[model samples]
Target chain A: MPSLFFTRLRQGQRTLPFPDAGPDLPERFRGLPIIDQSLCPSGCDACVEACPTDAIASDDSLAIDLGRCLFCSECSNACPQGAIQFSRQYQLAASRRADLVLKTGQSLQLAHRLADDLHRILGRSLKLRQVSAGGCNGCEADINVLNTVVFDLGRFGIQFVASPRHADGLLVTGPVTRNMSLALEKTYAAVPHPKIVIAVGACAIAGGPFREHPEVLNGAGAILAVDLFIPGCPPHPITILDGLLRLIGKIASPAAAHGEAP
Target chain B: MTISLPSFHNGEPISLASVPLLSIREFREEIIAAAGAGATLTALFGTPAESGRVRLFSVLGDPVAGGLAALSAEVDDAYPCLTVECPQAHWFEREIAEQWRIEPQGHPWLKPIRFQAPYRPPGRTWARLPGVTDFFAVRGPEVHEVAVGPVHAGIIEPGHFRFQCHGERVFHLEISLGYQHRGIEPALVGGPGKRTIHMIETLSGDTSIGHATAYCEAMEGLGGVAVPARAQALRAVALELERLANHTGDLAALAGDVGYLPTAAYCGRIRGDFLNLTAAICGSRFGRGMVRPGGVLFDVDPRLAADLTRRLDNALKDLEDAGRLMWDAPSVQARFQDTGAITAETCAALGLVGPAARACGVERDIRQDFPSGFFRFAQIPISRWSTGDVFARAWVRWLEIQRSGVFVREQLASLPHGAIQTPVGAPRPDHLVVVLTEGWRGAIAHVAITDPNGRFARYKVIDPSFRNWIGLAIAMREQQISDFPLCNKSFNLSYCGHDL
Candidate 1:
């Protein structure tokens, strides 16, 4: 009887740390897009299109928005440069939409400049909301992972408010598959005035790979007012963290990722 | 990949029998005839021709004909409809109907599961595709449609399940998917590269090894490449760990679903323990580090291997004690018994695999019948039973767990030392290599294309859920509404895995 009691005691003690540490969150646990920009091949846009979320962007160079990425890692795997990765930092969960917006890696200079430009244009504090255009769920999956225990993004003083009506910015993921226009339009229209749109993944920038689909209507920037552009297939979590940091001036410049030519 | 001439696949001319469907009207008839014959092929899913025509595929088990093979008929919208007689085919047919506009003519329950009504040219939105006839119009009394997802309240993947009937007893259910269709089929058609494994590994997070192992086997089979014996032993070890981890977690989940918190908590805690062990050897915990195209990517750490065996032996004893408590408790047994009962007939008709079908008395496991990788070695054992119910599922998974321990021991003792993987420079072009793995769930198949140099051309991954989701819809019939969590848990179909 004493031994059984001890066994039970041992079992209970083990579970003590419980969910405070968060979920098992598994390996390749697709959290958010974190780009090691140093590894990216500049002109290749496979990840941009691979993201069901338009969480990737590359008008000139690639950038990412933590707020919109799905963390599908389609880009990381598809990337010839091995520039993207899925980080284990899932607990960026937040209630507000904009609190999650983060730019990652050496690309922060562009993001900082873009954020300054947005602040100048708005002349006030800003908030952003994200909508997916024909992206695969990679970006969305990561974005959702952020809402879990580890990242608890709400602590970052940002929130992922569902509606765009009260937003200062808009984030987009995916290549704008033909089927998503109405939902995108509805989401876009729901946002209030003085909004700046940030295209997140590769798809929104140039329609990514699914560009010539007979059904798709590409170019998210064409649909709204543009601000900053972040690119990745599905960037990594740190990239997302970096992207948000860049927006709020927490980080001076976009950081370089691990294992790069630098 | 060798293309054998169309000999006789279940006594039918395989590829030559199909004709290009000209319109949607004719296609409806086909569904009607097949449905009447008790043919309930869930998804008419396959690759579309680059020339812009769709291949209409259906899985059938004809008593007169015999066996299950995906019967493909490439056609335009004018193919026949199978949904007319098969009322359960509303969602899949609708997806096919909207994506290709190949309507199932006589579908009794024509409803907009995904695509919105009043079809649009490019008006097809994400959740709302172009269009399918609205299903909400036919509402049963006392029960209203509760549209659950595409975006869920939990961290689970997106799948829209519509319940039909009054509040208490569910008369019927319709599951709508295709939300995360990342164009995996199209991506597979290009050169083979890392994407194949990436896509396969992520096919279902839990089913990773199953898919990857099967994929490596298929590619090797096609290329006729011999794997190093040491790598084979390591693959066996990895597979056992994966099975052990998945089964332990699943048993706990099943317990939790029935509201047994202790069992739930116990199993959940150990779930990651095995994954951590896997990481101790491989860089990634998902076992993604090894098992490449030709062979495994790396060797296991000998020290790590020794540690794993000890850890596993200890876990086995703890698990056994827990199982005793679970089986003896009346409340737990009450919660489990007949909660999710799938008949043997239903399983055979649907062709469900793994524990889901095994529990129902369907004695089919790819490891034994469709052998690959380390499975051919006489060292490992295959555990099975033919119950075909939730209890049966639990039984099979438990047996597998026990068997897993034995396999791990064998693997460690017989650990071979040698080079792990051969160099894969580039792929041979213009050939089709089909790879299949017996994932914890069941058969995981990967279709890879290599160009002349051995780099990827195109790769298609078909996880068991692609076939098993059909069993879920059928199994739910006559089950009480409250038991859905139990029923769904028994099958545990990976929504993200299938959506991709």
Candidate 2:
């Protein structure tokens, strides 16, 4: 017991002081993409052809939808003119799906806080029921890390409950498959009234890589009205925390936090 | 008469015509005889042949000889099952029957393995829901049944477990999966296009490097591309890092299951530290987009390599401390030592791979048996424990963690200098290739058969989970029902990996 105590003492406080300050993200970490239309050569669609998922739309102006983007940077690598670039900005959550789309030279906007009523109802604490519906366990594993000592998502009073009855909202992962659609719906219904659904990862938001497969229902949006969308192949734990904190009105919008715009 | 099966080396492409086509009777006889003579059946699947017939392929691995044999037989919808003689062929036979809609005549306990439609031309479907199959039931006054999951309490993939128990003691446990199946194999049939590598990386998301390496090796084999020694060393480093992270996480999860908090807390952080090292190398923590066909996408520069080595050393030190704390704890040892014990005989019979087999003293590691890529140059000693219990599994993981740490450090310090990426040509037409990668869990095998156009005609992936899930179920026999989580974590099999 004494040795165990000493070990714990050596480990020290492991949680990140996030929302107060951002994580020290790696330089190579792919996040919000920047598109430069000026750099794109005439009659070039290399990035469009290279994108596994059709996250890039190059008909007129270059635009990327974070909802479908896997952050693989294949498009960036494929572009000869260097038209597309992925920045290390990790805060890519959005309240509305349309907000996830970034046009040429546009930066990713932070997710909007919940309505005043929601803040009154769930501002202090949020209980989430995570349902992994056909997820490849990547998203599930990252979400699990939220509770670990490093991320310590519980410090924010956001807890993942075992039962849907106890949850205030449903945190759905995976590319909701046919076999899990029924269970996902049942889980959503089990959550009480005024329940919010937050879709985590590329799979939960837009089916990510398995997008057009016949077996998957695409994502959580096909079944439920998602209140917030967090994007990544599997969003990093910090990304998830940022999204959750923003949704619960725990953090200000990136624009407001920077004291620039509404 | 002794049957001669066409042999091929791992990561080498062979013409499909070279694999001898046997009659159904001969195929069954040969496979059964091979099993009797101590060969492990690696993979068995069927592809559509001419005139509504199916070409069934069987892969057998001989650990002693360090060789792999492949043979095929054409069957017209019905064939004699080999499971009657070879118990290891049970699940593989069921999978063939389910996917091809072929009837393995007179096979016992035949059922759908993935509960999906056939990929063949006719597409005769099985009209039943997933997890709604006939379960082996035990009935008596004291005997009761317990069904768990498809939706588990914790964060996990979906699978159904039905245990027949008598007063808290489990008699038999049947695991029914397929809830996580997304038809990934069918998605990979056409070509090695843009999405193929991404699909392979997520074949089992936790095993990103393992499956990705296997898929790349298969592609490179067909393309006849030799990966540079530097790229091979980089891949080995990433693969070992993946193993280290997962094994550390599993050890922590096992401690968590038994309520040993110190090891659980520290190891979780240590596991994340290892993942961060991978991320430092290739952006993503899971090593996504790091491994590409012909070579890896990212290169570990000298500075990053040094950083990785330093972090790895620190993490290894911390992991050793936590592991010592847990192993020395009497409570943890008491919970893990005898619970969920599977004998070496049972492990070999089930053809279990990875740590589960090694824990049973089976000595079956793909890295050793069929050396490919970096393994051919540098071999890490196989770590094995004889107990075949939860403790043995955890102990094996600790030993592996130490070895993998040493390997990663050594490779990082001496990283060969060269270009990381090489251009790969089109796959050879009408060829069959099998690539085996020892994933963190076990052996991940990918078999790709190309058409006349050099497109993938049939791609088969056999995750180690497919072979080890049964081992978990069998291990639960005569154990306490509540120890299920501990046993399940000790094995730590992948659901989607198995389902696909």
Q: How many Å off is the CA of B71 in candidate 1?
A: 7.9
Question: Once model 1 is optimally superposed onto the true structure by TM-score, how far is the C-alpha of residue B77 displaced, in angstroms?
Answer: 4.0
Per-structure clash totals for the candidates: 132, 0
lDDT of 1 by residue, B1-500 (tens): 01111211221212223323323344445545565665434335434544566655443333233233334456655444554445445445655665565555676554444343222134442345632224443454565655554433333444667667575666666676554444545555554443456556544555656767766765665555677888877877787788787787778778877887666666665655665566555544566545676677656667656777887777777777656556666887776677667787767555566778778866666566545567767434556555566777887888888877787887877687787876543333444444445677776655554544554543555566766776776666667777777777778776545654
Alpha-carbon TM-score of each model against the true structure: 0.66, 0.98
* C-alpha RMSD by candidate, in order: 8.7, 1.8
DockQ class, candidate 1? incorrect
Off by over 4 Å in 1: A1-7, A15-262, B1-76, B81-133, B136-141, B378-387, B424-430, B448-459
TM-score of chain B of each: 0.79, 0.98
Chain A TM-score of model 2 versus the true structure? 0.95
lDDT of 1 at B346: 66
What's the distance in Å from true for residue A220, model 1? 13
